[model samples]
Target: MKLLVVEDEKKLLENVAAFLERKGFLVDTAQDAEDGLDLALERNYDCIILDVILPGMGGYEFCRFLREEIGSDVPIIIITALGEIDSRIEGLKIGADDYLPKPFDLRELEARVRALIRRNQLRSEPVIRYGPLTYDSRSGVFSCSKKELSLTSRESSILELFLRNPGTVFSREEITDKIWETGFESRSNIVDVYIRYIRRKLEAAGILDIIQTVPRKGYGLRRLRDDG
Candidate 1:
């Protein structure tokens, strides 16, 4: 498994990264949230170890941005000196999967990381097949008729949402809410644009009319013929 540790404390960061590396995990370290965000966007890690206090863009904001703005679901464990109930609640409430107070044992932290990753794994369906389209959640790969289908990150996320909910129709606004942060322009036609992109890709793969559009409603994935 892979992990990212973002801590401003020089010694603590080095020690944690070394320990995780020794534990057979590919560990990446960052001293601040900005660099942490860069690494996060660049690579997919099984879990992230974050520190609350930092030089710029505190951990809380970083977590929020990762979840809301970037639409990431990677598990986060916040390590902070604030051990109060309120602080813990705020951490989870803002998208952290787990929290650990500073001065914590390295073993317990490892346990928490493993548990969170295990829980996330159990919560996901390994492979979802709808008609000729198949999605592997673990690999984040989509295949049509046993052939790999290439998709951009945002496009894949949108298609994954539809595949997971087979019969549910997602209105434009609903898709926007689920995919983009609240600050996105309400009048933007990005949702429709993305739907068009996805449809074109599916069509190129010989999967036609998979994305059904309701007149006044929005879009949904409907089974075609006996492809299911």
Candidate 2:
């Protein structure tokens, strides 16, 4: 599975990322909320590890915006030093699926991730029809007609989000936050860069271009009918 770690502490970020990576997860990270939010929104991940307190936009706002505003259902695990009752309530109320207080056990964190993934996996049928593709979000697997292929972590995240909420127009800012978690550190042309990468991969596999551009806006993942 793929995960994003959004912690401001440089040492902690690397430490967590390393542990997760060692456990066979493809992991990425951000130093602060801005960077984390950008990466979270821009790319796709199986789970996001968000710090509650962050610079630019705080962790609470970032998590809230993602669920309430962007409508991303990507599982969230809030990680922070604040471990009070109210904090946990607030985090859960806003949309985090799980919460882990800092100074936590790495093994516990890994267990939580596996549990969440297992829970999510049980929610899916064998296949979900999204456009021409049949997606098994749980397995990170996709097939269409006679074609079958495994998806990369980034590919799975984008596809999963698109399938969950069909016909939604996603802004680059929105995409950046949802997928990559680099909301506030964008230096221009970055969103386009990833979009192009996604497009190339789909095309390389002979899949139709379901990701459509919106000129000055961002892109939308479309479910084109058999005729359309």
> Ten-residue segment with the worst summed lDDT in candidate 1?
177-186
| Model 2 alpha-carbon drift over 4 Å, by segment | 125-228
Every model's TM-score: 0.56, 0.56
Residue 156 CA error for candidate 2 (Å)? 22
Q: Write the per-residue lDDT of candidate 2 for residues 1-228, one digit (tens) a residue.
A: 679988888898898999887665779888787787788778988888889988778889988989989898888898889968999999999999999988899878877886676566557455678656678655667776647765667666766666655777667665555566422577577767766776776776777778877777667776576674
Q: What's the CA RMSD for each of the models?
A: 15.9, 11.8
Taking the tens digit of each residue's C-alpha lDDT, what string does model 1 give over 51-135? 9999989999999999999999999999999979999999999999999998999988887887787667647678888878898
Q: Can you give the lDDT of residue 166 in candidate 2?
A: 70
Q: Model 1: what TM-score?
A: 0.56
